[model samples]
Every structure is written in structure tokens, then in C-alpha cells.
Target: MSSPNGASEKQSEQSEAISSRKWFARGARAAISIPAFILTAAFVGYAGLARETGLTLLETLAMTGFIWALPSVVVLTGALSSGMGIVPAGIAVALASVRLMPMTMALMPIIKVQGKTKNWQLLIASHFVAVTAWVYAMKHLPELPREARLPFFVGFGSSISTFVFVLTGIAYLLVERLPDVVAGALFLLTPVYFLCSLWGAARLNADKAAMVAGLVLGPVFFISLPGLDLLWTGLMGGTLAYLATRIWRRGLS
Candidate 1:
């Protein structure tokens, strides 16, 4: 049998554990609404748009859960629907995915455990760093404790993903039931959400400049090339913005 002191210590540990769980749950819930409203609009559009592309609900869900990047999903579905060959279509998807690299780099560091978290864990964690998650995490994670950040993010992001996943399916199913104009309006939500969020969240001159360049060039490229516009727009716009920012910083130095 344990001593009185040992029994009291065990009770204290249990109480502490319960309190930690409550604290973490509260933090996670706080993070949820950060992206919920914006992504609800965007993914509703994506779902309707995906249905138009003739992608099955399973395919839509797979893209949302596995790829988790809206722009890449748009590129892949468009290329596939256009009857592009698999290799070329894949290349286009890969090109669209390139933009996610910067988002990942900017976000994963916030929740990483350095030596404690393995490289593969970090790689898997990086997949969840999409535009919605990245923007919300960057905006809100600072208010959370270091230890609670990852769990809070996992809870918050998983809820958002699940919500969007279900909404996408529902929107896809409802697209036909709704009138044409309403469906079309739904399809436009993602870009509008992205435009507003990027501008609202941009903290640097370079970030604002890049977003403005993308905003201007995106329409031109879409008009010029139709379905393949996202690939070229991302590559060219991102490259130009990065180079221009680096040059400006160097000149300042």
C-alpha cells in the first residue's frame, strides 16, 4: 500500500490532468471560428464548382482531405475534366502545389517541437497548412500556450476540415436544386474570400505587393489561358514578388 503522501500526490496529478484537458479544449474551440466563416463560403463554392467539373463526391472529399489545397484541387479537376493526360495533369497540379510551400514554411514552425518532433511528423503536419489553416493559425496561435498550440490546431483544423468536407458534399448535391444564378454566385465565393483574407491578413509591404500582383495578374491569365491560368499565375506572380522583395531589401541594406 502507498503512503498518505503518495496517495495525495496521485490525486493532485489527476486533478492537474483534468484541468489541462479543460484548458486545451477551450483553446481549441477558440481557434475554430477563426477560419470557419471564410472557409464555409469558399468550400461551398468549391463543392459546387467541383460538381460542375463532374468529379464524384468521393473525389471531392479525397481532394479536400488529402490535398487540402483549394488551388491545386481546382487545377487538377479542371485539367482532368479537359481530358488532359495524367502526366501533364499531374504536372499542373504539382505546379499549383508550389504556392503551398511558402505557406507551409511560414506556419509549421509555429507548432513544431524542434528536437522532440520527428522530421516525418513535421512533413505530415505541413500538409494541414493550407490557406485557411495558415491564415487562421498565424493570426491566432500567438494567443495560445506553446504546449497547447499543436493540440489546439489539430482540434480546430480538424473541425473546420470536417465541416468543409460535409459542406462541399452538400453544396455539390444542392447545386442542381438551386437556381443558376445562386449556384454561380456560390462558385465565386472562394476567390472573393481569398482576396479579402489575403489583404486583411497581410502584414508586410512585400506580402501586400505580392497579393496585389496576383490579384491583377490572375484575371489576365485566366482570360488568356482559361483553365491553366492558376499554374502560370502562381508561378509568375510568386516568382516576381519574391525577386522584387529580395532586391528591395538588399537595396535597403
Candidate 2:
């Protein structure tokens, strides 16, 4: 009963759906990696922090699901524990999350499918542009068809985010039994994992230079300018690396 054009459209829709589902499954499987485990462990530490800050079960769960970034969650918790006002706490959390903006910017072009991918879809995908997901996407997305990249990243990010969210609730209940030192150490895992992952995955000399510069500058800034240490370290280290790499390239040329 359907016209030829209608049948072709239906068939094309079905094919697109099948491709998305297949890539989604593959992305979910890819989520079972060391970075995922490190992220989950980081959430375990967040659970303890949430409990110590007097957050209720519902609040803890909500923060885990909504904020979804350990550093931002930590900033919010720290602000609340210190009796900071809501507006200030929000600003602090936003600042902490600002680091993800560059990651999202780097990833958007990789996953975007020219005219076919919608801006709204990319917007949704940007929410999952954490360090772990960004690294995985950068490494794997090139291998996938352009159309599959967006769904694949969304699937991986959603699955990993959900997995951590559930584990955070369970960890919250068990956090009381964990030693303070152990919980703090658990929170440290993610940054260590992040640095190692970037170092290993980096393909360019500039990337390595930035890492080295950051490491060397981090402690110096922490001691001399504790309040703005992170800001200074990132700014100075990244600029230094960029200039150094450019100079080196020019000299070679």
C-alpha cells in the first residue's frame, strides 16, 4: 500500500536505527575500562565527602546524577561545608566545571556529522565531555563511521555516568565504615589516572610538554599562591609549552 518513496524512507530509517544500536553497544562495551573504574572509585570518595557535609540520601544521589563531575561536586561540597552562600557555591562549581569546556570544544568537531547531526544532539553530548570520555572518544572515534560517532560517544558517556551514579549511592551507605585516609586516597585516583591517560594517549610533543610544564609548576604555585594555584599553573604551563613547541618547530623548519 505504501508508495515507493515511503518504502525507501522507512528502509533508510530502519538502517540508521540499526547502525546507531550497533555502535551504541560497542561504546557501552568500551566503557569497561580502567578509566571507568578510576572514575567510580573517585565517586566513592565523593560519597564520604557528601556524608560528612551533612547531605541527605536524596541530595547525595541528586548531586551524583546532576553535577556528575567529581571536581565540581567537591567544590560544591566544600562551599557548603564552609557555610558559603548558594550563589557563591554555584559560581565555584561553574568555575571547576569550566575545565571541561576545552574538552567539549575539541570533541564536538570529531563527533559532528556535517549536515546530518543536529546541534541539539551535540549539545546533549557536550554534557558527557569529561576527561575520561573525551580521551576515549579521541582515541576511538576516528575508527567509526562519522554518523556513528555521536551515538557511540553518547552511549559510552551515558553508560559510564549511570554506572558511577549507582555505585555512588551504594558507596554512600558504606562510607561510614571506610577509614578517612582510604576515602581521601580514593578521591586522588581519578587525577592520577587522568594524567597517566593523557600522557600515554598524547600524540604530539606539545601535549607532552604541557604535561611536564604543569607538573613542574603545580607545586611551586601551590606553595606561593595557594588561592590561585590551579589557575596560575594551567595558564603559565600551557602558554610556556605552546611557545616552546612553536619555537622548536620554527627552528627545525
Among all candidates shown, the one with the greatest lDDT: 2
Residues 65-182 of candidate 1: C-alpha lDDT, one tens digit per residue: 8888887888888887899998999888887777687777777778876676567856765766788777777777777776556666666666677777888788777775556776
Global lDDT scores for all candidate models:
0.75, 0.84
Q: Please list the residue runs of candidate 1 whose C-alpha ends up more than 4 Å from where it truly belongs after superposition.
A: 1-24, 31-34, 174-177, 217-251
Model 2, 162-235: lDDT tens per residue?
A: 99999989998876756878976886788788888888767679889988998999899989986567778888
Model 2: worst 10 consecutive residues (lDDT sum): 94-103
* Per-candidate count of clashing residue pairs (backbone under 3 Å): 0, 0
Instruction: Tell me the TM-score of each prediction against the true structure.
Output: 0.74, 0.89
CA error at residue 80 for candidate 2, angstroms: 1.5
RMSD of each: 4.8, 2.7
For model 2, what is the error of residue 126's alpha carbon versus the real structure, in angstroms, after optimal superposition?
1.1
